[model samples]
Each structure stands twice: as C-alpha cells, then as structure tokens.
Target chain A: MAISVDYVVRETATNLRRNLLMTTAAILTVAVSLSLVGAALLLRQGVTRATLQWQGGVELSIFLNPDIAATQRDAIKTQLDAMPEVRRVAYVDQEAAYAEFKQMFANSPDMVESVSAKDLPPSFRVVPRQPELTEIVGQRFNKREGVKEVVYAEDMVETLINFTDFLQNVIFAVAGVLLLSAALLILNTIRMAIFARRREVAVMKLVGATNWFIRVPFMLEGMVQGLVGAAASFLMLVVSRGLIASALEGNHLIEQFVVSSADVMGTGLFILAMGALVGGAGSALAVSRFLDV
Target chain B: MTATRPAPTERDHWRRQLLLTLVAVAGGIVSLRLMALSVARERDVYLVIMADGSRVRSASYLVTLWPAAVALAAAFGVFASLVVHTYRVARFTFRSDIEPSPTGELP
Candidate 1:
C-alpha cells in the first residue's frame, strides 16, 4: 500500500499524544543527562583556562645569600642558564629585589618601610620550558652554593593538578552513567509505546503493509521526543551558564574564565546529535523486535 | 485427504539464503574487527616540548580509557547491523508476495 507523508506525520503525532507520559519521561531523562554533559564540558573549558593562567604564573625564585659575591652570583646564573630544565633566568639585584618586595607587600606599609635595599637578598627568577617541570628546576638549585632558598608553590601546584584530575574522572563517570540511563529510558519508552499499538500494528501487517510503512511513524515519534528533549536541555544549559557567570562575577580567581560562544554552540550541537541518535535508534530497535512483520 | 504444502521455489530459496549469508558474513567481519580493537594496546602518544626545548613524545599507555573505546566500537557495530538488517528486511517486504494460509499462517 502506498503511504502518504501526511499519514505518517499524523500517526506519529497520535502515537506521541497517546503515550504522553512515557514520552515526557523519555524527554526529561534525555534533558537531564544532556544538561549534565553540557555542564561537564563547560567545567572542562574553565579548568583549561585556569591552567593556562597558572602556567604563566609558574616560576621558581632562587634567593642568593646576602654575603654572596658578584662572581658567585654570576657563576650560579651561568650554571642555571646552562641547565636543561631551565628555560630562562632573570637576575634581580638587591635594589631590584627590594623594589619588587615593596610592590608585592605594598598592602603592609609597616613591613615595606622597615625593609631596605641592603636587607633584601638578590635572586634569580627561573622560568621552566614546561610548567610541570618547575619541580625539577627547584630541585636542581635548592641546595646549590650561593643560594639561600628556592621558592615555588609546590603544594599549591600539586593541589591544582589533583583537583583537575579528580574533576575529569568524576565528569566522565557521571556522564557515562547518565547517558546510559538516558538511552535505556528511551528504549523502554519506545517499547511501551509500540506495545500499546500492537493491535494496530498487527492489523497493518495482516493487510500487507510494508515494514517501513509501519516503522517510519514510530521512529519519527521517537525523533520528535528527542528533539524536544534536546531543545529543553539547550535552554537549561544556557540559563545555567548565565546564572553561574553571574554568581561568579567579581570573583578575581574566576574572572579570567571565559568560553567562546562557538565552543558552547559546538557542545550543544553534540548533545543534540546524541539525543537524536539515542531516540531514533532506540525506537527502531524496539519496533524491529516487537512489531516484526 | 492430507493437505500437501507446495515446495518453495529454488530461485526464491536461493535468494533468501544468499541474503542471510551476506548478513552472516558482515556480522562475522564486524565481530572480528571489534575483537581486534578490544585487544589493541591502550597506548596513545603526543608530541611535547621538553624542558630543554627539544620536542619529545609522551605516552599514556596505561592511562587510556580502554573501556570507553570498546564501548564505542560495540555501539557502532550494533548500529551498523541494525541499519543493514532493517534496510534488507524492508526491501524484501516491499518486493515479495506474502500470503496467509487457510489457518492464518503467512509465507
């Protein structure tokens, strides 16, 4: 029998309306999972931005002994400059060190006033080729001659690395679970919807209806559900992003975290594609099993 | 009198057999490919600049997400099978003549 596009569309709409509750459940599940995935993507971008800034701030300060002669300081600098771990080194004499200390501790006027150029120790500020190699640079110079101390935020760097790693694993685990749940829910919803219309399906098969004729409407129904779910999730993601940005406003630490609109849209498109696949594929599999002709 | 069933034509039988064989072969290939991917070593490498400014390769052989990769392969295989089977069945249904027997049995 020849089938009309209008008939298929009307049938799809009727199926969705008849199984409204299951359809709504499927859509909500998809929306929830997709939103979570979107949030995870955004969080990853934020962490990446923070890490880039952290890389720029990564430096090891090698403080010179107050009594160290110019020759000794030059020798230390030469040694450091030749090391494979060191990217570049800047020498800060007592006067420059004192100026930097004053600028750094400007908030504490009493401390700045009490310290003089003669009291501040000269130092070499060392940048590493890679941010992660800062530890190696510190270790190499930590006990060297003419060096009073090596200053680097080892604990802070370790904490940031641990935090990023934890976040990555957590996001993957949670998103995986949620996506699985969403796909299963879609499968179940389609199965139930087809089950309700089994009598109609049987009649169609008896009357020599082609398999595609009987399948297209159901597949379309599932696709519509997925599309709706994707749209809802996209809206939720945008609103949540706005809320998060507002909440984090004026926070100096997060002020630099910004994701381009294109990136956000790309993630949104991916979520939508996943939704469509889960819904359409889920329904197709369901009909093939339950309404086999 | 006993009712004798008509023998299915050789040509029709052969056509059906050929389609089934094709599907089976495709399924086998997919399974073999999946196995190979699963058994593959979980190693990935990318270029990075070392502290001395020379480019070097870093490997994440142990840290790769093998489970996810296998899962992705499995999903793709299943989807491909589904599409191929559905298309074949739909085409067969469209072309073949299906008639119900007196007891409502279809052939």
Candidate 2:
C-alpha cells in the first residue's frame, strides 16, 4: 500500500509528457479562467472601496454668502447642531475651503493657480444620522438669510451605488460562468488522460495496488497543471496592475482608485487554491471511473 | 490460478445503471433550479435595521442573489461529481471482465 516518492513523480511526469497537448490546453484554460476571476475580484474590491468612500463623504454643504457675518455663521452652526437629524456639523472657513480645493485639484496646477482663496466660500458640512435623510438637513438652511446654497452629494452617492451594484453583478456572473467552464475543461482533460492510461491502471489494480496508490499520480499531475496555470495568471495580473498604475500617472483622483496590494494578493491566493481544488477533484473523479474497491 | 475474481452479476449491472440514472436526474433538477433562479424577478424585499437603529430597504437582488449563486454552484458541483463517479465506476466494472488480468493468467 506504500508508494515511493520517485515512482510517483516519474509516473506523473510520464503522464504529463505523454499527453502534452491536452495538458497544455487544460493549463491555458485554467490560467485564463483564474486570471479573469482574479481581475474581477480586484475590480469588485475597488468598487466596494469607492462606494464606501462615497458613502462616508455623503453630507450637505451649506455655503454661506460672502457678506455673511461671523456671528451669523456661528448661530447657523449652533442651530444645525441642535437638530436631532444632524449627526455632526463642522464649520469650514473660507481659508480651509480654499486649501481643500487646492489639494483636490493639485493635479491640475493651472486650475489650482487660477482659483484664488477669496473665490471659495466658507460653509458648514453637515453629516446626517441617515445619509438618505440628508434632505431634511439641506432644507433646514436652504432659504436662510446668510446661506447662498444648500447641496448634498447624495446624487453622486446614489449614482455610484447603482453603478457599483451593477458592476458587482456582472463580475460575479461572469466569474461564475468562467470558473464553471474551466472546471468542465479540467474534467474533460483528466478523463482523456485517464483513458490513455487505462491499461496501466488496470494492471496496477490487478497487482493489488491500493486505489489511492493508483490515483495519487494522476492527482499530482492535475495539481501541477493547476499551479502552473495559477502562477502564470497571477503574474499577468501583477503586470496589468503596473500598466494601469502607469497609465493613471499624474491623475491623483484616478490614482486613488487603484486596487490595493492586499486585495491583489488575497485574490491571487484564493484563485490558486481554487485552481488546486479544481485540478485535484477533476483528476480524482476521472480516475475513479476506472477504479473499483 | 489459485484464485478467481467474482464475476459481476446481472443485478449489479442494473443497480449501477440505476445509480447513474439517478445522478443524471439530480443533475437535471439542479439545472432547472439554476434556470428558475436566473429568470426569477427581483422582489421579496425587506427592511433591515442597522446597528444605529436606522431602517434600510433591501432588495431580493441585494440579499438573495449571492446565496442563490452559491447554491447553484454547490448543486452543479455535487451533480457533476456524482455523475463522474457513477460513470467511472460503471465503466470500470463493465470493462473489468473483458480486460486481461495483470498476471497473464486468462489463457
């Protein structure tokens, strides 16, 4: 019932070499599927992060008129703070507003240079208990004497939420389809490999070799194919990330949307594990058809 | 030869075929369920209370789609595994009698 390491390795190598075309095809398909899945996962993470950032940024900005006195601004802030619907209120003076604007448009030096500190208005940023209830806060100061305009980023948040949800659905559906096809391809390739070695398998069985002893080599072969494919795809993903980062150079806003390394590595590991499972299970099932206990 | 392997009986053949048939039927049911879920309309929404006591409306698409997808995947996996195992076992048993023994004792 005991098998040697060299024997197992030699058998696995022989099987792979004997059916080189099938092995290559299976590897390539697995690589393609896993890479797509990895990309989709990264994209999903990026969108989720962006959506959360957008949600956290959801607030109402009540811009004050240039002529509004400091005392009036303080009074408005106090009123906003007194409301139960308002979770918190922060007063941003004209100077701070100018600074934020400059930072946001740092990529566009010409635009940032053209905007003067006096051009930006001081405002109160209100965070509501519920983001969807931001309108209640917006209307509170809409027609006030010193208030110039009341605006909430709710529209942007809503649009981003819808887009993110759509993207998530597309990612999941497409990934699912690709992974399933990859599984089937692996299954077919294993079946072919087992068919070619049927006689050898039967001989082993007749010699009283354990079923596991007969099956382990085939499983190892599949695992090697899967690992090679996963590694290839993961390399491609890393290269693509570099390409994207270079493409987005100089655009700070878009640069912020880059997928994190943690996400990339996590997704890579997940795909690698999945590849192994697909390969091992596929070969096991294929060989099991010809084996009996 | 000192030993003779037991020959497969007619009942064993029928039983193996029946098992494979059942696997196929189960696969069909899984496929049907997947299709139904895919075409299912987006409804069955409910309100969820957040940690802050705020209520949020959740659509079926948001809440149920992932689980449905997972269920479909599980079904596909189980069906596929069962089909392959049964088919492999049936092939092995059917061919065992015709294939020559390793010891070259058939003659």
Candidate 3:
C-alpha cells in the first residue's frame, strides 16, 4: 500500500508521544546550545559596534621647539595641512598645554603650581585619515624644523584590536563545541526512538513496505524536536534581550553594546536553521543503522 | 541458507550515495569555519589614537559582516539538502530478510 500524508503525520506524532521524556531532553539540549550560540553572536556584534565608535582614534602630537621662530611654525602648519594623510590639525599653544598639565596634575597641587605657561611647550595635534596611517603621518615632521618630538599611542590601538580578536575566537569556539554536542544529543535521541520499535521495522521489512514509508515518520519526529527547540531558544533570547542590554549599558563606556532588533531576529533565524539541520541529519543517521541498508 | 546477496549495482548505488552525502557534510563543516573568520574580520575596528591627550578622527575598513551570515546560512542549507536526499534514498534501500522466525512462522 502507498503511504499517505496522514499516515506519516500520525505515525510521527505517535513516535514523539511514545518517547516523551527522550524528546523533551533532546529538545532542551538543543535549546540551551542554540541559546549560547545566539548570545555569543550578539555579543560579538555589540563589541564590534562599540569599538568602532570609541573615543580613541588615530592621532599624533607634534611638539615644537620652545625657541622656534613664528615663521617656521607657520610653515610646519602649512605643510601639515597639505598632506593627504592628515585629516585635521589643531595647534595647542603654550597656555592650553599648561592648562592640560594642571588638569593632569590636579591631585598634586604643588606640581600644578610649579609648572607655568612658559614652561609648557606648544604642539600640533594631528588626526590621520586612517588608523594604520598614524605612524606614517607622524614620521613626516620628526626631523622637520621647529619640531622637537612626534608622539602617538601605537601600543594601545594594537592591544585593543588584538583583544577583540581573542574574544571573538574564544566565544565562537565555545559555541561551535556546544553545537556539536547538541547535534550528538539529537542523534542519540532519534536512535533510541527507532531502536524501541525495531521489531515493527522488521515486520514492515518482511512485507512490501518501502524504507521511506517506515523512515519518514522517524525523521519527522526529529524535525519536530528540532523546530520546537529552536522556537524555545528564540523566545528566550527575546525575553532576556532587555536584561542583557541593561546590564551592559549600565557602564557608560560600553553603552553602545545594545544590539538592534534586526540582529536578534537574524540570529534567531540562524538558530532555527541550525536546529533543523541537526534534527534532520540526526534522524537519518540513526535510522540508517537500524535499517541495515 | 544465508539471505541472497544484492547485485553489485545496488551496492555501488549505496556507496555512491553515502560518499556524496559525506561530501555534503564536509562542505557544511568548512562553511562553519569560514563563518568564524568572517566574524573576526567582519567590521573595521577603530583605535583610540591620541595626540597630546586629545582624541582624533577614527579610521574605518568598512568590511561587511554579511558574509558571516551568509556562510552560516549556507552551512544549514547544505546539510538539510543532504539529509533530505538521504531520506529519499531510503525508499529504494536494499534489505536482507529472515528465512526463519522466532514465532515459528517459517521453518
């Protein structure tokens, strides 16, 4: 007899109910694993966003000789403005520099009072067109007349980028490992479901029933588990999004760590798709062994 | 007597299908690795460069993160397609049957 749609659906439902506890365990494992994957993804996106908009950027400070002539300093400024690598330039006079020193040393009133405006050197603050070009831009005036020194925060920038890379690697690796475990759990669940009814399968084999007729129901059971798990995971993400954002946003430095709704939705779709794969493949492998074909 | 052995052609069919399915699984795994790389390089990172204690304009690479999304999605699609193919193959799978049953239906 030909297998009908209703037969497949009914059989699948029966199998799911027959092993209720196993089904629940598999789905819960899938949900938890997918949730971790989603959280890691959202965090990566948030951190990347915050770092791009961070206050620290490519800049250089060109300190001029205190006894430099006015014409020489003007010439240096003119040359800086003409360079393609320089985005903008600001001249910090001796008074502004002295004020900065006082602010920096405010905790030590004696130090603040000791350095007068005349003791502070004037400097040119330069922003580079690109972060990688910061060093190149600073090198230009290193030997130029009226320039005493060129300074840029090179180490700090490299450290931040490297840190983010390390973080992304660690998080994604954990997610990947968890996903594998979830897939294995799904496989075991399907195998047990099929094994419990191996006798029925042998009977069907004795008759004219095709393997597809017997296998469809089991596969569908797996798919159902996967889809349900995905739904639960998605719901969890939606419910906890506010708490996650609030916790992270409590810090002013990383207030931009909030992911957009679109990010959440996208990650949810990914989890759903992943769940389906693990389910479908898991059932196929489990049934294939018992079928001995 | 032992159950009848299947034709060589049937064995070859099963082997070919299994091999192809394995290839699909490999593709899925490779896509996952690519996704990790995509996430790492997905966006342009900005450095907080300072000149005389003052912040400067941020640099950007403008790299897109869409590839990460695409890679992950492709992995799922590839695995799902292979799984469905495997299920369809089950319809024509070869099987060995018993000549004697514990219920004494056959002697």
Top of the candidates by TM-score? 3
Span of ten consecutive residues with least summed lDDT in model 2 chain B:
B41-50
Task: Tell how far residue B54 is off in model 1, in angstroms.
Answer: 29
Best-to-worst DockQ order: 3, 2, 1
DockQ of 1: 0.02
Query: What RMSD does each model have against the real structure?
Result: 16.6, 15.1, 13.4
Candidate 1 vs candidate 3, DockQ winner: 3
Each candidate's DockQ: 0.02, 0.02, 0.03
Return the lDDT, model 2, position A229.
Answer: 88
- Estimate TM-scores for all models: 0.55, 0.55, 0.61
Model 2, which residues run further than 4 Å from truth? A61-76, A79-124, A127-156, A251-256, B1-107
lDDT of 3 by residue, A130-213 (tens): 877888888888898778778775443444455455555555654565566457556766766676777677788777688788
Candidate 1 lDDT, tens digit per residue, A105-156? 6666886686677776677888888878888888877888778877774433
lDDT of 2 by residue, A1-293 (tens): 89999999999999899999888877976787687678767766765765566566467778788679888988998898789988888988778876776665566687667666677777888889886678877887899988887767654235335634654555555455556556655766777677666777777788789999998999999998988888888988888878977887985444545687788888889899988998988888767877852
Distance from true position, residue A117, model 2, in Å? Answer: 26
The runs of at least 3 residues in candidate 3 whose Cα sits more than 4 Å from the true structure, single-residue gaps closed, are A1-4, A55-72, A79-88, A93-95, A105-122, A127-155, A208-211, A246-250, B1-107
